[model samples]
Target chain A: MSTIFQDLVDTLRKSTLHFADTKKLMNTLNIIVTIKQVPDTAEVRIDPKTNSLMREGVPSIINPEDRNALEAALALREAHDGTVTALSMGPPQARDALEEALCMGADLAVLLSDRAFAGADTLITAFTLSRAIMKIAKYDLILCGRQAIDGDTAQVGPQIAGFLDLPQVTYAEGLELKKGGSLIVQRGLEDSNQWVQVKLPALITVTGRINHPRYPNLYNVADSCDDAKIKIWTAKDLQLPQAMLGLGASPTTVKKIFEPDRKMKGEMIPGDERQMAEALITKLKEMHVI
Target chain B: MIQLVPEKCIGCKLCVKACLFGGIAVDGKVPRLTDSCTGCGACVDVCRVEAIIASGEKTGPVCDFAAYKGIWVFAEQHAGKLHSVTLELLGKARELADARSAEVTAVLLGSGIAALDGELFRHGADRVLLTDAPFLANYRTAPYERIVARLICEHKPEVILIGATTTGRDLAPRLANRLRTGLTADCTGLEIGPEGGLLQTRPAFGGNIMATIATPNHRPQMATVRPGVMQARLFENKKGETVRIAVSEEPGDGLVQILKTLAREKSSVSLEKAEVIVSGGRGMGEPKNFKLLENLAGLLSGEVGASRAAVDLGWMPHDHQVGQTGKTVKPRIYIACGISGAVQHLAGMQSSDIIIAINRDPAAPIFQAATFGMVGDALKIIPELISQLNANT
Candidate 1:
């Protein structure tokens, strides 16, 4: 066969496969939204002695941006008539955030909790998540928050994409499904916004600006926690190797943690607003800033 | 652990060019693995067709990490413009490089931006590796990661730094994954550690704690520094050599398309540039009341800032937020109005020269750090202060 004939055949073959894939994608979306439960950052505090967050009394919530991820998955499901699965990795208590996702109308909730998964860094976390994702097959889309408020590392989603070897669109602020299972997305960057087109079976890390998550209903919250709707998976359940899912698998280790000293003893100017404002402006003048 | 989904390949030899081990061979449009494959996943990224699986990867001992020399910075450029964090990294990198008698190299990839290489040297880089190609105009993860990873494999650098901006957050992880190396993100401090490894210190657990991380066994220790965290060395008149690499212009995988791009940002009064920042919180009542802070800022020639609460309340935009999740500001004076000084809010602005709190509650945490504290209604105090400042100025 001529080289031109072979090239044409390859292009035609790829296009037809994509066209049929799009037909299936348009009708339904099997979406997995990954979320992390974190200590409410507002009340977060660090122990000066140990140099770590004092999570003892601090309450945990779904990491702020993860709500946007859940909202994105729910929106896609609402538009395409499909199942939305909320997946979270944390201690057993992290199940609360997954239940919240269920309350918000997710079809399935999963909590990957086990003693073995403790102290796992982003790389190990991505490894464990990818194993579960692959085990639960037929997922067409994966959504994640831009970053976790606790770890503050945005690496997991992209690392998961790397593990699964899938194309990824990060900072996905807007999305529109196109014909043939392709998607038009608006990505918010540091300086400007960019619109890009990507195909299905893709991963996206969304920012909080993407959408305001809907509140969970009172009745739905009760139903979501029902045993039939939520499943708890351990390392063995996912058949994940013991060495690959925990602190032993982590590549980076913290040598030390310390509280940063940001305090400065300052002279308090006592007074009402009028007197304080006068004194502040006077001090600015004394410092030659006014 | 490295495998290839042969069906995903498009007969592209880009991966063949990427692999330094000479282990990936293409025949009949499919890649076959060889015993020599070092499992260095560099080819994983370049194969935008997503054919290479570098996962389940457990690193077997790397070549002596000490063999890598020189400190390199990824000089980020967008639309022919450079990010300031690159200059900051160059400044710090120069110090580390000199301490170890190593050279400082800047790795820059963008179309038609090689001409800006001289600026990199003025800031501290000894050499700039320039890769220019039309396909490099818009920042795509695969192409950019491939070029950098391929270069790192060829010319091993002891340390690599990237800006922790949006592009950095997206690209750095992919590069680290491809190299199967350790990456520390949003590092505020970088120092040469014991045994010559790079010690990266960053605020972890929501800025409540600082964690010092070290990559003891990884080559080309990689870290991303957030913009404004490090001071950029002042530019000097100096000449630097540039080594240009010829990049292939082939459209990568054609997996993602750039449908449209918004233009560059307009120049606005940024909180980072403000010397005096007068910020309001939810106690400001409504968005319209923010005008009081704006008026005071105008009289003081400062910027009006907001707490995450105000931004969340829709009283202000996220850009105006001054907190952990928002822009960190080190203004000369930060006046708080009705903000209770939540830890998240204080994490971004506690470095100010002087803090003044104006909450009605005397026991608000904002008063703890404030040089001056006032007990009053923010609504009444703000308007009166705005009138007083306007009258005085």
Candidate 2:
């Protein structure tokens, strides 16, 4: 077994470390920031025949929100003592994103690549990530972007938490570590922002407003390109369940994902408030919209 | 498994004629699925060539929730109080369950919420699964996760509804993952479909389309219902049974401890939660001028909002700014005042139910997108409109 996997087995066997003893057991936090290399959504097109994303031609970027997640992890490293690991599950070309993350100061980068993982959706993606995270370390925390731009599902991070039986906070805009191994986070939900305190060994999917990402220095960029230390783990390396690796493992499939017709090409109404309001309300009433 | 290899298919009309469900139709040289084809091999029967293959899908462990029979909702709590969205979910779930001839059950987890089980029933639950633990007083994932996962595994409800609050968002996925079940997030609508499947509908692609998803193969279909979309029906006198279960997972083991919970302070009109909003832009001119919009908003019982340009010019506070850099609002009505809208500003409020733009510049892009538009100055038009509204009301 890999030493990282062995560490997890050892940690599990040793019993839960008390908050007081945790600081002594590991002074530095081990954080794994899960990211994805999604095709630039701005140029997204769907293959009508296949109903799959046409990811060709549109260059891939480290998912925009993942950049904020990486920035959050980096900030956590700056505040506390820890190494941030950038991890992704995608095709072989996903290495480019890992390289970019390394340039942005991720301490270690790992990629889980295999033809078996190609059609994995959020559930399977989370399963694959949890396996890699276990192989990486008995990490104290896992961070992810709120959602990838391509799928925009916001499911993977929390799903990973489920697989690992860990606590999760999604849409986190602010995060901080408390004195006794607790994590304080500002979660931005659909309607409100809430401050929550969660115990360690948690996962947080950060929102884009969390932090301003820093551009990597030229030296670091070239260095990461030349000496990129990305560990590639496949199904065999993780020794995961075969059913959970590919499409066969997926519990749900996209029946269809065509763009909807929500576009409103508004028509200008010539009138003042009395005329416009009455006319508009009348139209809305006619449609039973009001 | 099905593959549509455009190159291999010889544009044979045989498969088109062979499809039983009319799922396939010829679109130019290639065949396109006019409807959702079941991949039932009818087309493969008459392909006359190797182009169509009967690919078998490996059915891995059919852990179907089909055996489950009751509809369940997770009554969400914050700081020991139940949320309104819980009621919303229960109302919707109760309707769906009644349609399927199933009972509505609610799972309540908290320190001292047994007495509150009545509240769940009042909102529509027929039964309550109450797990009260000292550790459950605060919303922590570990304890709640164990109870939810265990309850689902044991009871095997036909459908589970959860309010898509922050707590539900975090807790639902973890529990669903543990159950190895499918969950639809941020769903706006739910109904019982064929074979008692939960038809979960939600907006996708930036609210451009509404997608209805179902978990036919999985049992106990789960959905996280969005708040405010569903009505919260309350009964003066309600009936329900409370079942207590012993939780196996200890509370504190969830390594994370809550030291403090800071709820976001809503001092003034939060643009996000407001039902109606009237926003001003830089064209309103001055900080004092915002009062005119506020007066108009008061007459309409709405909140005053600001465009990024107005906020940037110190006419209004930054907290009120609406755009890409600001909070997105989905109010019932959005009225833009003197605002020549920018794309960034439009992105924020375009999703509102009704958009009314009042700008002197008829050429402004906002006019093109507004549900109603008027070419006039805010200084002259809004006061007259407010006076007219006041006189009418």
> What is the i-RMS of every prediction?
3.8, 9.2
Per-candidate interface DockQ score = 0.34, 0.17
Q: What would the per-residue lDDT of candidate 2 be over residues A1-290, giving only the tens digit for each residue?
A: 12233244334335643222121223478889998887665455445455454567776678889999999888888788788889998888787788778768787788999988877756678877876776675688899998776555678898887656566778788998989788888876544666778878888899877998886533344434433357888888876546546776666655544443324466666676567656655665586544
Question: Candidate 2 lDDT, tens digit per residue, B239-292?
Answer: 989999766556444565555555556558677788889899977878898888
How does chain A of candidate 1 score by TM-score against the true chain A? 0.82
Model number with the top DockQ: 1
lDDT of 1 by residue, A1-290 (tens): 12233244335434533211121233377899998988887667555455456677677788878899999888887787777888898998787777678767787888899999998877678877876787677688899999998878799998888767677899999988786898888998766789999888889999988998887754454445465667889988876556555877666778987766545456666677678767767886787867
Evaluated on chain B only, what is the TM-score of candidate 2? 0.68
Q: Is the docking of candidate 1 incorrect, acceptable, medium or high quality?
A: acceptable
Give the chain A TM-score for each candidate: 0.82, 0.76
For candidate 2, give the docking quality class from DockQ.
Answer: incorrect
Q: Which regions in candidate 1 have their CA more than 4 angstroms from the true location?
A: A1-27, A45-54, A217-223, A226-228, B1-36, B39-57, B60-63, B250-253, B264-268, B282-288, B350-388, B391-393
Best by TM-score: 1
Query: Judged by lDDT, which candidate is best?
Result: 1
Chain B TM-score of predicted candidate 1 relative to the true chain B: 0.83
